[model samples]
Target: MKILCGSAGWTDKTLIACKRFYPADCRTAEARLRFYASQFPLVEVDSSYYGMPSAANSALWVDRTPADFTFDIKAFRLLTGHQTVRESLPKDIAMAIPETGKKNLYYRDVPAEVLDELWRSYREALEPLRNAGKLGAVLFQFAPWLMCGPKGNAHVEECADRMQEYTVAVEFRNESWLNDRHAFDTLELLRRRKLVHVIIDAPETVTNRAHTLWQVTNPELAFVRLHGRDAEKWNATGAPTAAGRFDYDYSDNELAQISGPIRDVSRRTAKTHVIFNNCREDQGQRNARTLMKILGR
Candidate 1:
């Protein structure tokens, strides 16, 4: 089985502060990336979800990492239909849009021209990685409110069509997308579109726990993202941010329980990517390394 194990992102402040994985000389971005590439073959670009990435930076990344290293980039906030701040948009995009004194803009609010520009820029930014054969996939994780229905399906199809040149992975945060009645059909939809279904392990007590379903939808590439089971903070409205929400470490037994399923999925697919999203400290990295040891990868 072709299994790639990694953490969601390498730049977490907690990972740096822990001073466990990186050497002191690995301080700058290039040094850190070089060191990280030495340790892991894959990494997910979580920062790209917060802001648009530059082509120059992407090219620099290709130069810094080894040829075998691969990157899975998160889709930009706007592309995934999240509530993005008006100020977060690029200057050209902001100027092109008609401002109605709104503080935030949803994917629906953006004009067609602005959306096209944003999509074009995102694809262009990834060209360097793609050319170097370091680009694994572009992950499109939809918001919790994006339920299963005609509208939701349309949006998913539109995203797939726009990025048809690249491999796309789809992750749904909403429970409605996967239930007893909808699970098979939803998986079939992703299969038909050639979208890699993102399997996740998160707190099961949350209102949106339906996303915990672990079925494989695409045979080309399967993904498993382990977000530690922190039930208390999973849906805590008082929590400051996602950093707090996903703050938990997996025990040996918990990780052991997942090992079988991961191996099973990897055996059936061309490649399987297992990423840890529990980035509270070095917790995600630690758990990911532990899993790698368990799988003997």
Candidate 2:
């Protein structure tokens, strides 16, 4: 089994601003990506979740990274049932929306034709990565309110169907999906749909937090995203930036403790992707490197 360890995204304001991970010469986007790939075999594209990814940028990623390197892209906010801003949408698509004075748009707010176009464009943009065999998986991280129920199940199935051509990973933020009552059903659902179950490591003390489930639904791939255990930030009120929410760093003992389950899950899948989402400054980069050493990858 192959275990690929890396960070959620290469470009983070604090990661670059801290001047700890990237070299002094690695100022350009291309340079940073190239340098990151040299250190790790995998990475997750976090920016795509905020806005539509461009085909040109996708092609540039393929050209910049090595052949064996791969990227797991986060699905667009609209596709994942997240509240997206008008500016995040394409200019033409945003114009299509009637002047309803709505600043935020959800999946239901978008017209059928416009949504179809979005799905098509999203798929087309990632074609370069898929064609070059650099695509890892399209991550569909459902919102916390998406509880385990019929409607939620249907939405999950729909997302899998939409990205049927590519490898899809599902991450549920709600605890209901993996609680004692519905854990079995949730795993079964993913297994039946051939969707990779994303195992997350997050603050256990927080309400509605998804507990770390070591179960692997897809034999082809198992995804693990480590969001450091900082209950205060995770449970904070008001709007919290990505960095502030996932700012805690993993200690050596913490990494060693989790390595066992990670190794066990890797054995059952063809490949396992372990992504560090504790993206405060260079925390993820440093933690991922340490985990790689622990796993002897």
Estimated TM-score for each candidate: 0.97, 0.97
Go through the candidates in order and give the clash count of each. Answer: 0, 0
lDDT (10s digit) by residue, model 2, range 175-261:
999999999999999999999999999988886677778999999999999998988887677754545789889999999999999
lDDT of 1 by residue, 8-97 (tens): 898889889999888988999889889989888899999889888889989999999999999999999888989888677778887888
The 0-to-1 C-alpha lDDT of every candidate, in the order given, reads 0.88, 0.92
Residue 121, candidate 1: alpha-carbon lDDT: 90
Model 2: residue 154 alpha-carbon error in angstroms? 1.4
Top candidate, metric lDDT: 2
- Badly placed stretches (over 4 Å) of model 2 are 239-242
